[model samples]
Target: MRGRNIKKAAYPYILWTALFVIAPMFLVMANAFSAADGSFTTANFARAFEPIYLAVMWRSVELAAVCTAICLLLGYPAAYFIARLRLKSRGALLFLVIVPMWMNFLLRTYAWLTILEKNGVINSALEFLGLPKLNLLYNSGAVVLGMVYNFLPFMILPLYTVLEKTDGTLVEAAQDLGASRAGVFFRVTLPLSLPGVLSGVTMVFMPAVTTFVESNLLGGNHFILIGNLIEQQFLTVYDWRFGSALSVILMLIILISMGAAELAGGAGEET
Candidate 1:
C-alpha cells in the first residue's frame, strides 16, 4: 500500500516529463526525419552538413571553446582565492558573484549594450581621457565578453565547492615531502579539482554554444553562429524539418562533448 502511494505521488512528475520533454523531442525527431509532404527523408541532415552551415557550426564551437577556456582560467584563480579566505569573507564575496545572476538574463545581456556601444560608458570614459572612442559593440569580442560575464559564475561556483572540500592534509603532506608550491598545487590541488573543472566546463560550454541572444545582441548580423542559423531556420525561414535536424545535431554534439569530458575527468581522477 505504501509503495503504491509512493508510485502514485510520482505520477504527476512522470506525466509532466512526458508531456513537456519527451513529447517535444518526439515532435522534433519526427519533423527532422520527415519531408514537406510527411514522407520520411534524410536530406535535412545532409543539407546541414553543407559548407555554409558547417562554418556556422565551427564558429559556434570555436567561440564556446574560447569562452570555456577564459572562464576556467579566470574562475579557477578566483575560486581558489575565495576558498582560502576566512568563512565570513568567503561568503560575502560569493554573494557578490551570485548577485548579478539574480537579475533577469536578458536584462544583464542588455546592460552590456550601454557599456559597449560607440557612445557608451567605455567610450565616454575614453573621450573624457582625451582618447579615441572605440567601436566595441556588435563584434565577436563583444559576444565573447557577454558570454564570459554571464557564464563565469557557473565556472567559479563548482570550483569553489570542490576546492573548499579538498583535504588540507594532502597539501601539508606534499609540503612535508619538500614539494615546491607549484608542485604541490599542480600535483595535488589541481588534480583533485578536476571534477569541478569538468563540471564547470560542461555547464558553461553547453549554453554558450547554443546561445542566440548574446550573439544576436552583441554580434549583430555580421556574425552568425550555429544557434543563430537554427533560429533563422525555425522562425525566419519557417523550415521546421531543417531546424529540427540542426537541433538534433546540436544535441548530439553536446552529448558527445559531455561524454568526453566525463571520460577525461575520470582519467584525471585515476591518475
Candidate 2:
C-alpha cells in the first residue's frame, strides 16, 4: 500500500513530463518528417545536410570544441586550487564563482557587448593610453569568449565536487612511494577526477554547440552557426519543418557525444 501511494505521488511529475517534454519532442519530430502540405517526407533532413548547412554545422562543432577545451584548461586548475583550500576559503571562492550565474543570462551576455564594442570599456581604456581602439565585438573570438565566460562555472563546479571527494590517503601514499608532485597529480588526481571532467565537458559542450544568444549577439551576421541557422529558419524564413530537422540532427549529435563521454568515464572508472 505504501509503495503504491509513493507511485501515485509521482503521477503529477509524469504528467508534467508528458505535457512539456515528451509532447514538444514529438511535435518537433512530426514537423521534421512532414512537408508543407502535411504529407510525410524526408526532404527536410536532406536539406539540413546540404553543403551550405553542413558548413554551419561544422563551424558550430568547431567553436563548441574550442570553448570546451578552454573551459577545461581554465576550470581544472581553478577547481583544483579551490578543492585544496581550507573549508571556509573553499566555500567563499566557490560562492564567488557562482555569483555571476545568478544574474540573468541575457544580461550577462549584454554586459560583454558594453565591454567589447569598439567604443566600449576595453577600447576606451586603450584610447586613454593612446593605443588604437580594437574591433573586438561582432567576431568569432568574442563569441568564444562569451561562451567560455558563461559555461566556465559549469566545468568548475563538477570538477571541484569530484576533486574534493578524492582520497587524500592515496595521494599521500603516492608521495611516500617517491612520486614527484607532477607525477602524483597525473597518476592519482586526474584519474580519479575523470567522471567530473567528462561531466563538465558534456555540460559545457552541449550548450555551446546549440547556443544562439552568444553567437548572435557577439558574432553579428558574419558567423552564422548551426544554432543561428535553425533560428533563422524558424523565425526569419518561417520554415518550421527545416528548423525541426536541424533540431533533431543536433539532438542526435548531442546524444551520441554524451554516450561516448559516458563510455569513456566508465572505462576510466574500471581502469
Candidate 3:
C-alpha cells in the first residue's frame, strides 16, 4: 500500500516530464528530419555542418568555456567562505547570492545593457572622473559578463550545498595530524568537493553554451554565437527544420558532455 501511494505521488511529475520535455524533444526530432512538404530529408543536418555554422559552434564553445572558468574561479572561494561562516550569517550570505536569480533573466540582462551602454552608468561615472569611457557593450566581454552575472548562482549553490554538507570532522582530523590550512584544503576539502565542482561546472557551462539572450543583448550585431544563429534560423528566417537540426545537435553535444561529467564525478567518488 505504501509503495502504491509513492507511485501515485510520482505520477503527476512523470506525466509533466513526458508532456513538457519528452514530447517537445520528439517534435524537434520530427522537424529536424522532415521537409516543409512533410517528406523525410537529411539536408538540415547537412546544412548544420557548413563552415559558417562550424565557426559559430567553435565560438560558442570558446565563450562558454571562458565563462565556466571565470565562474569557477570566482564562485569557489565565495561559496567556500560562505560555507565556513556562522550558521546565521551563512544563510543570509547565501540568500544574497541567490536573490538575483529570482529576477527575470531577460530583465537582468537588460539591466546590464543599461549599465554597460555608452552614456550609461559605467560610462557616466568614467566621464565624471575624466577617464575614457570604456567600450563595454556590444562585444564578447560584455556577453561573458552578462553570462557570469546571470549564471553565477547556479555554480555557487551546488558548491555551497556540497561544501556545507561536508563532514567537519575531516578538517579537524587533518589539523590534528599537523596538516596546515592549505594542506587540509588541498588534500582533504578540495578532493571531497570535486562532485560539487563538477555539478557547478555542468550547470554553468550548459546554459553559457546555449544562451541566445545574453549574446543578443550584450554582443549586439558585432558578435554571433551558435545560439544566435539557431535563434535567427527559427524566429527570423522561419526555418524550423534547420533550427530543429541545430537544436538536436546542440542537445546531443550537451548530453555527451553531461555523460562525461557524470563519469568523471563517479571516478572521483570511487577514488
Off by over 4 Å in 1: 1-8
Which lDDT values do the candidates have, in the order given? 0.95, 0.95, 0.93
State every prediction's TM-score relative to the real structure.
0.96, 0.97, 0.95
Write candidate 3's Cα lDDT for 116-164 as tens digits: 9998999999999999999999999999999999999999999999999
Pairs of residues clashing in candidate 2:
none
The window of 10 residues in a row where model 3 has the poorest summed lDDT is 221-230
Q: Candidate 2, which segments miss by more than 4 Å at Cα?
A: none
Model 3 alpha-carbon drift over 4 Å, by segment? none
Candidate achieving the largest TM-score: 2
Per-residue lDDT over 1-271 for candidate 1, one digit per residue giving the tens place of the 0 to 100 score: 9999999999999999999999999999999999999999999999999999999998999999999999999999999999999999999999999999999998999999899998989999999999998989988899999999999999999999999999999999999999999999999999999999999999999999999989999999878998998899999999999999999999998999899999988987775
Candidate 1 structure, TM-score to reference: 0.96
Counting clashing residue pairs in each candidate, in order, gives 0, 0, 0
Q: Write the per-residue lDDT of candidate 2 for residues 113-223, one digit (tens) a residue.
A: 999998899999999999988999888899999999999999999999999999999999999999999999999999989989999999999999999999989999867
